[model samples]
Target: MENAAWYVLPNEADIETPSLIFYVDRIKENIRLLINMIDDKSRLRPHVKTHKCIEVTQLLLHAGIKKFKCATIAEAEMLGLSGADDVLLAYQPVGANILRFIKLIKQFPNTNFSCLVDDFKVAAQLAEQASAEDCIIQIYIDLNVGMNRTGVLVNEATALFKQLSKLKNLSMIGLHAYDGHIHDSEMRVRKEKSKPIIEILKNLSKELEEIGGRKLNIVAGGTPTFPIYAKETDFDCSPGTFVLWDKGYQDAYSEQPFLPAALVISRVISQPAKELICLDLGYKAVASEKPLLNRVFFLNAPELHVESQSEEHLVLSDTKSHSYKIGTVLYGLPYHICPTVALYEKAVILDADGNIQYWDIIARKRKITI
Candidate 1:
C-alpha cells in the first residue's frame, strides 16, 4: 500500500548541520594523555576559553580537573554556576563594571575565584571591592614572556607583585606566563624558543620567594605551548584545545593523533560549474583570520578544494574533476577552534553512531566586555 515515489524526509536537527560537535570519547582520551604526560607535582588548569561549553567543562571536571583558566568573567561565572569549585580569570579587568565581578563573587561565595593583574592599581581596585564585600580574591601575576601581549614585562613583574602584596583583600596566588606567539612548524624550534621564557619564570619564582612574598600556587601556560612547557617547566599547565583537537593544532604538529571532533557541517548550496561547488557557510561559520591557511580541508572529498570564502558563501573547486552536486554535505575542520566556536549559536553533540544526541549553546552568548 506504500507509494513508490515516497522519499525519506531529511531531519536537519538529527544531523550535524552547521554546528560544532565534541566527541566525548576522544576528549577523555586526550585528557588522559595530558594527565599522564605531567608529573606528580603538576596540575592541569585547562583553559575554558577554547570550548566554553559547560558540558565539555563537566567532562573535564569528571576527569579530575578542578582548576580552570578563563578568558572572561562570564566564563568564570558559568563554570562556578556549573559546579566548578575553582576558576581563574586569566585576563585583566578594565572599566567601571565592578558590579558584574561583585555579582559573580556573591553568587559563588564558597568557590575559589581569582583574576590576573599586571598593574598594582587595578589589583588595589579589585581588592578594595573585595574588601567591601568581605571576600578574599586571589591574584596571579601575568608576566610577559616575549609575546608582547597583555602581560607585564618579565623584569617589571616583581615590582608589580610587591604592590599587589600590599592589598589587604587580594592574595597573590601564582604566576601566569603565556608564550602564544612562539608556535612553529618545527617542535624543536618551538621548544627552544620557550626555554628562555621558562628560565625567566624560574628566576622570577625564586625572587618572589626571597622577598617573603606569598607562595606561588598556579603557574599556567596556554594551550598551544603546553607540550613544550609541560615537559620542561615545573608549573600547572593550561591547554584547552586538547579537549577538542582542531585542524590548526594538527597541522602544527604534523601528526594527526587526535580526531577532529569539532567540524562545520556545510552543504553545497550551489554548483556554478561541473568542477566548482559553493557552500552556504563561509567566514561567518569558520574563522576569517587565516582563511587560506587554516580553512579549506576535505573530509569526505579529498579531491575537492576550498578555493575561496566570502561572508556567506564558500567556493570549492575540484582539481581532480570530482563533481559535487547541490545538497551534498561536506565537513570542514577549522584552523582555530576558539574564534570559530564563538561565531556559532549552538553545537551539536554526536554519539558513536554519528547520531546527534543533544545540542548545547548555553555559553555561546555569555561574553562580557570587562
Candidate 2:
C-alpha cells in the first residue's frame, strides 16, 4: 500500500499536485486498541464531540458501540438522525431551553435520549418539560468528583438524586462523573486522587439503591480516566479521543506504544531560507493545545523540526542544514485531536494502496438549537 502523490512546481509554470494524504487504516487500529481495553458489558458511550463526523460515528457503531455521549443537543440530534438509537446529551442543559428540549424529545421518538443535570432547578425544569410533552426522560446526576467543573459536589448529590426520584416524568437513571483531570501523564497520581471520589460514588450508589430500591442504571466515567476508573469504579466509560489518538495522549502514555491515527496533511509552500521550510497547514487546520510534534520522522525525516505555525502556514526548521526543497509534503500530529478534526470541513480517507477511498465530513457544522 502506497500513498497517492500529486506533482506541483514551486513556480506558477509548474502544475500543482497532491502533497499529503491521511490514512483511515491507522484510525481503525486505534479504535481496535480502545475496544480491546474494555470489557464487553462495559458500555463504550464514546463522546461525539471529538470527531463530530457521521462517518466516524457510524464506524464506531459498526464496531459494536451503540450508545454515544454528546456534548451538545445539536450533536445529539445529528447522531439520532444518523440512525443512532441511543444518544446522551451529556452537557448540562439549563434555563430557557425547555421548549427546544421538548422539541427534540418529540422529534426522536425511537431514540433513547438522556441528559445531565446537577441542580434541582434544572432537574425540575427537565421534569416539567417531560411532563408537558408526556415523555419519560432519563436523567443522570452530574457529580463533581475533583475537576470542579460543572457537576454538583459529592455531598449534594444525594439530595438531588432524592429530589429527582420524586419527579413524575424524569427517571433518575444513573450518575455522571467525569474525572477529566486523569490523563495519560498522571494516570497513577490521578487514580490515587480519584479513589476517594470513587468510594463516594460506590457509597452513593448503595444509598441510592436503599432509597430508591433499585440499582443505578448508568454510572459514567469520561475521558482517558476510563482505564483506571473502569477497573476500580463500577460505571460505564465514555472516552472520546481513544478512537482517534492524539499527540497529547501519546505523550501521556510515553512508556506505551500508541499510534496517532489523525494527522494534518500539509504541503511545503515556501522555502524562504536555507533552514526554514514553510508548509501550507497551520493553526487553522490543527489544534493549538499542548505542542505539535514532528511526525515526519515516521515518513523518514527525523531531523525535521516543527518550529512555529501561522493561520495557514507551518514553519519547519532543520538545524543541521539538511536539504529540504519546497513542495515537500509533511504530516503533522495534532496536539489535541478533538478540536483539530472539528476545524476541517472534510477528511480525505486513504486506503492501503494510497487511493482515495472517499471523503466524509457530514457532521462538521455547529450544533443546532432544535
Using lDDT as the measure, the top candidate is: 1
Q: Runs in model 2 with CA error above 4 Å? A: 1-22, 184-186, 254-258, 291-302, 351-354
Total clashing residue pairs per candidate? 0, 1
Q: Which residue pairs collide in model 2, if any?
A: 6-18
Lowest-lDDT window of 10 residues in candidate 2?
6-15
Writing each residue's lDDT as its tens digit, candidate 2 over 18-101 gives: 222235666677677777776663477788887777777777777777888888777887787777878888877777566666
Please report, in order, the local distance difference test score of every candidate based on alpha carbons: 0.74, 0.70
Task: Estimate the TM-score of every prediction.
Answer: 0.90, 0.87
Look at candidate 1 and tell me the lDDT of residue 56. Answer: 82
Model 2 lDDT, full chain set: 0.70
Q: Write the per-residue lDDT of candidate 1 for residues 1-370, one digit (tens) a residue.
A: 1442111113443564455655576778877777876774237888877777788888878877788888778788768866887888888776654556767777887678877889877777888888888887777888888888888998788788777777898778788888878878787787788788887888888889778444686465676677766777678888888777787888777532555667777888888877789988778888788847457465666676668888989887876756577777777778888888878767776566756565554556665332
Error of 1 at 181 (Å): 1.6
How many clashing residue pairs, candidate 1? 0
Runs of candidate 1 with Cα error greater than 4 angstroms are: 1-16, 351-355, 367-370
